[model samples]
Each structure stands twice: as structure tokens, then as C-alpha cells.
Target: MKRRKFIGLLGGAAASWPLAARAQQTRMPAIGFLRSSSSAPSQFLATALREGLKEQGFVEGQNVQIEYRYAEDEKERLRNLATDLLARPLAVIVADTIAAIQIKAAATTVPLIFASGGDPVAAGLVTSLNRPGGNVTGVVFFATLLGAKRLELLRRAVPNAAMIGVLTSRTSPNVEAERGDIEAAALALGQQLTVVDVNGEDEFDTAFVTFIRSGARALLIGSGTLLTTNRARIIALAARHALPAVYPHREGALDGGMMSYGASVADAYRQAGIYAGRILKGEKAADLPVMRSSKFEFVLNLRTTKALGIDIPPTLLALTDEVIE
Candidate 1:
């Protein structure tokens, strides 16, 4: 009887071993991924980040866990969402530019990594890019700085468009600076520009109307989370209005916009993921220098050009990095 009892006890212990191992796996380090835009539109960016993490040997679900939260273009919800993320037992927090600002404002002590489109110093996220000097560091793609380049590309595509319309977001932190850049570029190119600001999606129709009434012949979509989140709608509107438009990211061209000139947003997110992995591997966020995105893409859509009946200048076509049919 005693031998039978010992055998049963050993069997019971063996049966519980797998559950113990699973419980330990469940306790693996988790990363908090916060974005200020909608998830569906930015899924590719998330995948890019995961790819970066994988490069650092931190595959999600197998070794590390990633908790993703998106505010869906609602800026007001960012802080609360960030706070909720903070409530989790996370190893690191990775956020987009706007979401980083809100999370920093909440005074989080977690290791924070940001994928920013604007200047990190100007946004008060870091003291300097080289040495962040705090629990914050990530990537800066400088998308806002490419406004003039986008304007130039649009002008090249629509050489006869004298009155160019600009659609800018009023709520973006870098709005005024981007507007100033576009205006200065337009002035230098000897082009008349009509600038219209939209605060929400409801105002898009009105803004388009204002642009048309102002005799604007082309459109320059400004850089911001708001504009990027609603890119499809804006592209549809541009097509409906028969406006030759230039966008700030390649995703815009891929989605049927006329053209786009900007740094790779996916690469920036991937770099941010690398930073997160580094931090997870015992590197300090403050010690990691901010990475500047070096990959820029000039994408043009032939379908959009045909729809708008614009002839692509051969010189511009030669300079394009990617052409969509």
C-alpha cells in the first residue's frame, strides 16, 4: 500500500510540472505599445516594430509579450490610455510622438521609448537627442521637416498648378512650424498657396470647399497624426475634387495619393522596437541615443496620375523610389 501511494504522488507531481512551466511562461516580460492613431490603419507599423523586436531575439508570444493600445485619433483619450498601460506590469513602454508626450506628462517612471515624427527637443520629450538624460529615448523620423520637400514634389508633378491648397491640422503640436515651412517653400517656388485648417473629420468637406473656392489647383496634405489617421478619406476627397495632391508618407501613395516624400515611419517604429528590446536586455533608456531615420521614400502612384490626367515629368519619374500601378 505504501509503494502504491508513493507511485501516485510521483505521478501527481509530474502532471503539475507542465502547468508550472506554463505559469512561468505567462510571467514573461511584457512591452506596452501605445499609439495615438487607430490600430487598423497602423497595423503595418506594429508589424514593423515586432520585426525589430524579433531581430533582438525577443519574439512576441514565444519569449516576450506585447500589449497594444491605440487611442484611435482621439487625443483626449491618450493620457487615460497611457495611465491604463502604466497600471500593467510592463517591462517597457513604447509610444508614438503624441502618445509619448501624454505619457511623459503623466510622469511615468517606466522605461519609455518614442517613435517621433517631430523634433523631440521641441516637444519637451528630451533634453537632447544624443543623450536623453532620463528614462526616455527612441527614434525621430523628422516627418514634419519634410513639408517643403513634399511641396516641391507636388509642384513638380503639377507644374501648371499656380494656386496650391494646404490642408493642415489645427490640433497638431507641430502645426504652426509645418505650416510655416510649407508657406516658405511655396513662396520660394513662386506659387500661391491657400492654407486651410481642419479641427476634425466633420470639417474636411468645408475645408475642401474653401480650397476650391480659393482657386486652389493642387493640394499639399500636412504632416500630423490627425492627417495620417484620416489619409484614406483625404485621398478620396482629393480624387473627387480632381486635385493633384502630395502626401508626407509612402503609405499615402500606396493608398492612391498622387505622391509622397518623407522618412520611413515603419523604420522609425522598428528602431523604437529595437530600443525597447535593448532596454529589456538591461540597457538604460537614458544611455541609448535617439535614432534618426535615414530611409526616405519618394513614392508615386501611376493610377492616381492617370485619374487626375497629369503627365508625370520624366525627371520626377526617374527620381521616384517606388511607383505604384
Candidate 2:
């Protein structure tokens, strides 16, 4: 070959090398993060998920890529968002309970890791907790089943209240289960319960009004993405009414709700992230048993309690995992 041709060939190869490297970087494995709620309220959960991914040596934007889709609490948008994610070449999908249900309905073949507060079996997300024999498996925090526990705690905070109001979401997958649990507990405790369901923020005022009219002296906020997303508004309403309310997640107490009892939502998300990382590393979702989150936190906000002129029972305080002063 001519000397000039050889030099030109080398120059072309060097230029192509950078393009090749860029192409390779762009081809990094991607995972989809889908949620049925708004992003701002659940930012901490997302951070926890990233931390878990990091634990498995997968960092977003470095070795793995994450594509996020949020429905902003609109149930109708979930299927569309999921369909969009499914169109991509995703190694796995990490989604909240409702979003996971919708994705499965879409007949997606990709591995799915769900962070759910409800019963995965009841919701048909999986076959069983011990063996989730499908392309879907994830973390269950049992937030739905904790209604009875929350009711017991709420009664401790307001022992003499003739009626306790329960606020739940109509759209929640766990609504029926949570209602049954709370009702059974209420009956067992000889507590009169007035349960109200709201589908959106617009219906909150009506729900509160119903509770007030029903002579509900205390409140128990139920588990659901919608309820968790609109916690601030519900907290304000409870405060305005001077009602002592118990919430399902720690964030509620952190944001000024009187108290909260349930599993650590952030931890559940982290567990789902870990599962997603493992799936990316060639583990089948079917082979990985559904993980039940073991970390449960009962947070009591002394400030909120004091503001409402409510006293926390000594026995209940003893059982608290955290006291936010």
C-alpha cells in the first residue's frame, strides 16, 4: 500500500474508534421505573431505590440506565405510560403496585419487580409470596394488612372516641382487604367505625365532611398510592378539623401527621431495586421469591400530638420505633 493511503486508513480507524465507543456506551442495559403516583411526593423512595441499585454495582447513568415514567396520580395514564416503557428494550421494570398491575395487563414479557403495599397474591400480581412463579416478583411491605394494627394504635391515642373514621382510596387494589381488616378489628375492639372512600383530591372535602357528620372523633388513613401521594392535603384537613389521625407510612408523621404505622416504604423500594439489579445480572424473576419487607416503623410526632391536645398512651409510646419531637 502507498504510505499516504496507510496514514489515511489509520486516521479513519481512529475517528471510527470514538464513534464505536459512544455506540457501546449508549447500548448499556436499561431498566424502567414506573409509578402510578406523582414524582415529588415519592422522591425519597426513588433515592432509596438508587441506593439499592448502587449496592448491586449498578449506578444510573454509568453502568445501567433508568427510564422513569410517572402517572401523576392519574390512573388512566398508567397503561399508556407502561405501554411506552414496554416499547423500549428494557432488561427489567421496577414499578409500584398499581403500575405493576397495569403493566402485567399489557402482557409485557420483560421481567418485573414491584414494590407493593398490598397483597401480591390477592392482586394477582403473583401466585404466592414464597414462590411468585411468573415474570413478576418483588417486595411486599404488607401495608394493606396493617389496618388492624393502625386501628389499635389510633384507639390508644383516642380511647374514648365513640367513632373512628377510616379514609381509604376507592381505586386502591387493596381497598377491600384493608376494609375487611379494619372492620374486623373495629368489631373486636368494640369501636364504631365509619369508613369512607375517596377517588381523588376533589372528593377529599366530601369524605371529611362525611366523617364529621358521622361523629368520627379520630381518623385512620388507609394504604394506597393515591392516599400516600395526597398525604399533605389529608394531613392539613385533619389538622384543620383538629382530628387525631394515624397514617400508614412514616412520611405522614414526618410531614406532621399525628402518627404512622406500617412497613418502611423506602426500604420496600430499595428491595425492589435490588431485585431489578439482580434481574439485570441474569437472574430470572420467577426464580427469585417474593420478598416481604421486614422493617416496620411506628412513628409518633409529639409536636402534632401536642398541637392536637392529644396524649399518647404510655404503653403505645413504648412500642413506637421513632418519636419525632
Candidate 3:
């Protein structure tokens, strides 16, 4: 009887040991990263996000596992990718664009941390930026506001231009939604707006030709991951057309666009990263307040302006965060 009792006790202890070990093994959260742009690993933006995560004590490989998926400009790929990622028990899903919309369409149960270029409310990603009612929340760029500011800066840079061409990707995720904002800015500046729409990577030349024929004296390049990816072609086209152009990214200005004014992308990435870290640390997405960019950066290229015979105003020069002489 004693030997039988000992064997029963030993069996019970063995059964409970695995459960105890699992309970104490330090649960590592999983982060699912999905983006519309190329996963520019070398970008300081990626580093900033990691730094923010580290600040929350979430080590990428040790304490947390990050499953990175890049669509690299293919919208359809995000849908399929989201479906596959759903199989994993992700702690948080960082959906960084219209890609978020796609991810949500596929997986509604998983909490989503989205970083979007347009109004979150309008995109149907969340109920409100402050209190995103469902299992989704993150950040907004308020791209419309950014567009208006970019136009304001462009007008300051080229005060004499009467006709302004706004170049946008026709297939951009939020192109239709952003038209009104750009239109309003054009009216405010009292400049004739020639909205040039390019639908594909190969359509830039056709659009620039149309801009010239349409009597555009200057250009306003829309902010989109797609357009920025083809920065070299865009810059070359602007130069070939001899049009003074403003872009939404500093990289564009650095590549010789006349000017740029928009959210500090790296700053937004860091902010998003912090939110991801919080989620990884067990913070609910709905409770984590989504933040808009606090600052916009202005970059000016004097050489590009000179090529187009546009002399930037002193007032504009004074406001620039960076100027390439």
C-alpha cells in the first residue's frame, strides 16, 4: 500500500511540473510587423523603433519575437500575408499603412497597432485617435495637414509662381482622400492647381509632360511610399522638366528636390515603436492613445531652386530646419 501511494504521488508531481515550468518560463510576446514600404533595415527610422522597444525592456530576440513582413509596394501581398500571420499567436500587429486596413479585413480578433498616413477615423481603422474603440490603435500622420503645410512652404519658396502642379500617385492608398486638402491649400495660396495623376511606375514621364502642357510653373510632389521609392526618377523628371518641386520627405530634398516639409518620419517610427513596446509589455491597444506627429521638418535645396530660377524668400530660409547650399 505504501509503494502504490508513492507511485501515485510521483505521477502527480511529474504532471504538475510541466505546468509550473510553463507558468514561470517568462512569456515572450510576439510582434507582427507589416508595412507598405520596403523594410529599409538601414534606415535610422527602424533603429529608432528598436531603441524605443528596448527602452520598454523588450529585447527583440530574447524577450520578444518580431515577425517582419514587407509587402514592398504590393497591396495584394498584404492580404495574403495577414492571413498567414494570423496563424501565429501574435501579441501585437503593427500594420503601417493601408496595409492595416487589409490586415483588419483578414484578422479582427488580433489587437492592431496601426501607423497610417491619413485620418484614422476616415480610414475606418479606429473610432477615434484618442480612444480607438476596438482592438485597434496606433498613430496618424494627418497627411492632409502635412500636405497643406508643404504647399505653404512651397509657396514661400517660390513666391512668384502663378501655376502649381501637384503630382500624386493615382493608385496611392489615400489619393482620393487627400485631393481636397491639396485643393484647399492651392486655393489658399491663390495658385492655379494642376493635379497631375500618375497611376504606375512607368507613368511619371507622361504626367510631367502633361504638367508642362498644363502651364505649371512649379511642382508639389505628394507624399507616398510608392512615389518616394522612385525618388531618383522623380528628381530626374523634375530636373528634366525644369520645374521647381517640393516633396514631403527630406530624402527628396536631399536628392535635389527644391524643398520638403512634413512629419519627421523617423520620429513617427520611434513613436510607433514605443507604442509597440507598450503593447508587447501587455498594454491594450485600445487604451494606448494614438499620437500624431508633434513636429514637421522643413528641408530646402538651394541648388534645385536655382536651377528653376526660383529664389527662396528669406522668411522661408529662416524657417528651414535644414538647407543645402
Per-candidate Cα lDDT values, in order, are: 0.89, 0.91, 0.78
lDDT of 3 by residue, 1-325 (tens): 9999999999999999999999768667888877665666325555666777887887788888788887776767867778878889888787666678888777767888776667777778888878887788887765545777777777777677688888887656678767778898778767788897786678888889889998887889886666866777899998998888888767788888888887766666677778888876677888887888877778889888787777777877889899898
Model 2 per-residue lDDT at 237:
99
Write down the worst ten-residue block by lDDT for model 3: 37-46
* lDDT, candidate 1, 31-53, per-residue tens: 99998888888898899999999
Q: Is candidate 2 or candidate 3 better by TM-score?
A: 2
Please tell me which predicted candidate would have the highest TM-score against the true structure: 2
The clash number for model 3 is 0
Candidate 1 Cα outliers beyond 4 Å, as residue runs: 1-26
| Model 3 residue 292 distance off true place after TM-score fit, in angstroms | 1.5
TM-score of each: 0.92, 0.94, 0.85
The collision pairs in model 2 are none
lDDT of 2 by residue, 1-325 (tens): 6999999999999999999999987788998999999988878888999998998999999989889889987867887898899999899999999999999987548999999999899899999888898799999898899999999889888998899999999989999999999999889888999999988889999999999999999999999999998999999999999899999999999999999999889999888888888988899999999998787899999999999988888998999999999
Supply the global lDDT for candidate 3.
0.78
Return the candidate ranking by lDDT, descending. 2, 1, 3
TM-score of 2: 0.94
